[model samples]
Target: MKVVLASASPARLSVLRAAGLDPAVEVADLDEEALLDGATGATPAAKVTMLASAKATTIARRIADTVPEAIVIGCDSMLHIDGELVGKPGTPEQAAERWKAMAGGRGELVTGHAVLRTADGGIDRAVEGHAVTGVRFAEPDPAELGAYIATGEPLVVAGAFTLDGLGGWFVEGIDGDPSNVIGISLPLTRKLLAAVGVRVTDLWESD
Candidate 1:
């Protein structure tokens, strides 16, 4: 079966590519803020999963006719710290402030995944789940934080940090699937694919 990734995240695409599946990328266009704002009383995991499902559903409809037979994967991530949930900081000052609050603290990085099996121009099956990884942040000195922020790497990543990029310098360690912290979880994705009646290996690119 063909694999389709309904996200624009290079990190997620890289993860899939490294795992042997070359997926087609189709960025999902949605009002993320509106979805989150309307997700009242939902837990962090639920909220992320809901967002993922919405993304998958949106892309599935768009490609139902052109790419009718494929498994569409959608993912969303957020960092939950001290009762607050945060996604991409989106601004240097906000990223800096998020770092200041996250420094030397532990947070849960939750990634939501949605897998949809599209067949005959419609969704034939669906499965959704989430993964949470515990992140241990190292306190960065003022100069280090300032210089890192100047690089602007944190502004576009969840929780204002990254596990495989420059932000790794400030992450002391992680408990659970490291891939999850990178924005997608291989193990979880495999299980989700199976749940949707597709073998994970079937989606791998042939050598």
Candidate 2:
């Protein structure tokens, strides 16, 4: 079966490729802020799951006729700290502030994954799930924090940090799947696909 990634995240793409799957990319055009505002969920997991399902369903509906046998996957991530949901900081100053607040503290990184199988202009199967990881940050000095912000990597990622990039050094530890912290969980994705009666290995690209 053909695999489609309904996201524009390079980290997610890299993860899939590293797992030997070649997926076609068709980013969903979503008003994320508006969706978040309208979402009704009691926890981070529920919210992210809703968003991921929306993304997958939107893309699947659009491409179902063209790629009827495709398995579309959508993912979203957020950091929950101090009873708040945190997304991309969008600025160096905000990133720096986030780092300061996160230093020596622990937060939950939740990533939602949704899989939709398209068939004959509709969805044949679907499943949505989420993975959460507890992350502890190492206390960084002001200079180090400022330097990391200056690198500009944190501004575009959830929680203003990354586990596979420059921000990795400041992450002291993770309580669960590290890949989920990077925006997608390979193992979780595999399980979700299986739940929908699709084997992850079946989506691997031909050699």
Candidate 3:
């Protein structure tokens, strides 16, 4: 089966490539903020999963006619702290504020994975799930925080931080799968694929 990644995140793309999967990229154009805002009272895990499913289904329906046997994968992530959900900080000030709030604190990085299998221009199988990782942040000095924020890395990433980028220095520890913290979880993706009757190895590129 052909594999398609329904997201534009470079980190997510890099994760799949590192796992030896050469998935075709097709970014889903959807209003993420609107979706999140509309989902009232949903838990962080449920909200992410819902968004993931929407992305996968959107892409799968769009390309099913051309790639009937394709497996479309979609993913979304959020940081849950003190019963609140956080996404991308969107601005330098917001990023700096988020870092200040997160310093010396712990939160759960939740990533949702969804897979949609299409056949003969129609949906065949679908599966969605989420993986949670406990992350602890280090209390960096104000100068260090400002310097990191000036890099502009945190503004575009969920939780206003990254484990595989410049923000790594501020991360004290992590529990559970690290890939999930990067936006996609390989192990969780494998399980979701299996749940939809496709093996993870089947998505690997030909040697």
Candidate 4:
């Protein structure tokens, strides 16, 4: 099956490529504010699942003509601290503040992924369940937090931290999939792909 990625995240793209999956990109600017609204009541898994589904479905509608018969994957992630959803920080100050809060604390980074089949006039599709991973961060001094934020790595990350960047220093360890923190979970991606009868290797046999 042809592969389509319904996300504009560079990290997610890098993860997919590294996994040997070469998928076409069709981005959708999901209404994240609306999506997060009233989400406090949901478990972390449910929240991520909802956001992932919304993103995948939105792109599926947009790319129906361009990639019919292809399976589109949509993914979303969030940082859950004490049952609160934390998203990407839009500003440097916000990034610093979020880091302060997450420092020395363990949290869950839930990644939700969906696979939508655009075949048969977009009538058939399958969405994978939400994937959850646990991460721990050692407490950092204010100076370190400021310095990491200045590097601009935390601003674009879902949990206000990037395990592959300067933020990596703060990571104590992870209890589950590390790729989930980066943006996509490889094991979960493999499972989703195989469930749809396509493996990651199939996408990169030539490349």
Per TM-score, the best of the predicted structures is: 1
Each prediction's number of clashing residue pairs:
0, 0, 0, 0
- Across 2-84, the per-residue lDDT of candidate 4 in tens digits comes to 77788888888888887777778888887788877868688778888888888888877776776557878889888988767
Worst 10 residues of 3 by lDDT: 198-207
> Which parts of model 1 have CA positions greater than 4 angstroms off?
205-207
lDDT of 2 at 134: 99
lDDT, each prediction: 0.93, 0.90, 0.92, 0.82
Better of 2 and 4 by TM-score: 2
Which candidate has the top score in lDDT?
A: 1
lDDT of 3 by residue, 1-207 (tens): 788999989999899898988789998899998998899999899999999999999999999999859899999999998788999999999988888789999999999889999999988999999999999999989899889888889999999999999999999999999999999999999998899898877666451
On lDDT, the stronger of 1 and 4 is 1
- Candidate 1 lDDT by residue in tens digits, 64-89: 88874888999999999999999999
lDDT of 4: 0.82
Per-residue lDDT value at 198 in model 3: 80
Clash list (residue pairs), candidate 4:
none
- The better-scoring model by TM-score among 1 and 3 is 1
Clashing pairs in 1: none
The clash tally of candidate 1 reads 0
